[model samples]
Target: MQHLEEQIAHLTRTVEELNSVVTNQQSEIDRLTRRVEMLLQREAERAQEGSGGVVFGDERPPHY
Candidate 1:
């Protein structure tokens, strides 16, 4: 009976440790996702700016 109780305690401790590790990994994933979204927004802005520059793609006025 004592041996059985000891085994149960050890298993419970192992499961608790694994749960903490999974929780930490989820938080890290959320942080990285936000960073990627910010980078994508900045890239889109840069592309739009390039398409509207002088002597590039935008149209010029009359009297040239």
Candidate 2:
């Protein structure tokens, strides 16, 4: 009876510790996910600002 109670207490503490670890990991993951999303959004906007690759035939090239 006492031994069982001790085991339960130990297991409870372990579960609480694991829950804390999981919570911290989830917070970190959320931060990273937001950062990645912001980076991708910036990249998308940058892509949108680029030229469409075609230029007029009369335009001077870079070698000029």
Candidate 3:
């Protein structure tokens, strides 16, 4: 029936729209994941070089 066809079409469109949104979100997640990985690697290297001067708990900073 025409009504059934219309409902199917509407549902299909909605599904497509949701799929596109999910794809975009996945791409953004992937990009952010890569950035986080790069930052972690950079921080690890900085730690190895002992240049970050990261303060630990209950420890005062060098300027303090």
Candidate 4:
């Protein structure tokens, strides 16, 4: 029936829109994941070189 066809069309359009949104979000998530991995690698290298700005819990601030 015509009504059923219209409903299918609307549902198809909505699904397409949602799929596009999900695809874009996945791309953004992938980019952010890569950035985090890079940062972690850099931090690890800095720690190995003993040049990282890591502080211990018992250490006081310079102004203390």
Candidate 5:
């Protein structure tokens, strides 16, 4: 029937739109994940070297 066909078309469009949004979100998530991993690796490397004269939150200030 014409009504059934119209419903199918609408549903198809909705599905395709959702698929596009999900794909974009996935790409963004992947990019962010890579950035986080790179940052963690860099921090680890820094730790392996020395504290680099960095101060900790709990420690007293240099003027103390």
Candidate 6:
């Protein structure tokens, strides 16, 4: 029926829009994941080299 067809079309469009949004979100997640991994690796390397320069709570830096 015409009504059924219209409903189906609307549903299809909604699904497509949702799929696009999900795809974009996935891409952003992947990008952020990569950035986190890179930062972790960089931090690890800095730690191994003993040059992390990380300040702990209540601990004054050498320059201060």
TM-scores of the candidates in the order shown: 0.71, 0.78, 0.83, 0.82, 0.80, 0.84
Tens digits of per-residue lDDT for model 3 on 13-39?
A: 999999999999999999999999999
lDDT (tens digit, per residue) of candidate 4 on 7-47: 99999999999999999999999999999999999999999
lDDT score, residue 12, model 6? 100
Instruction: Name the top lDDT candidate.
Output: 6
Decide which is better by lDDT, 1 or 5. 5
| Candidate 2 per-residue C-alpha lDDT over 1-64 given as tens digits, one digit per residue, 9 for 90 to 100 | 9999999999999999999999999999999999999999887877798843456798887677
lDDT assessment of candidate 1: 0.87
For all candidates in order, the CA lDDT equals 0.87, 0.90, 0.95, 0.96, 0.93, 0.97
Whole-model alpha-carbon lDDT for candidate 5:
0.93
In candidate 6, what are the lDDT values of residues 1-29, reduced to their tens digit?
99999999999999999999999999999
Model 5: what TM-score?
0.80
Segments in model 3 whose C-alpha atoms lie over 4 Å from true places: 54-64
**Residue runs of model 1 more than 4 Å from their true location after superposition:** 51-64
C-alpha lDDT (0 to 100) for residue 13 of candidate 3: 100
Which sequence of candidate numbers ranks them by TM-score, best first?
A: 6, 3, 4, 5, 2, 1
How many backbone collisions does model 3 have?
0
lDDT of 2: 0.90
Q: Which candidate is the best by TM-score?
A: 6
Error of 2 at 12 (Å): 0.3
Weakest lDDT window of 10 consecutive positions for candidate 4: 54-63
Instruction: Find the number of clashing residue pairs for candidate 1.
Output: 0
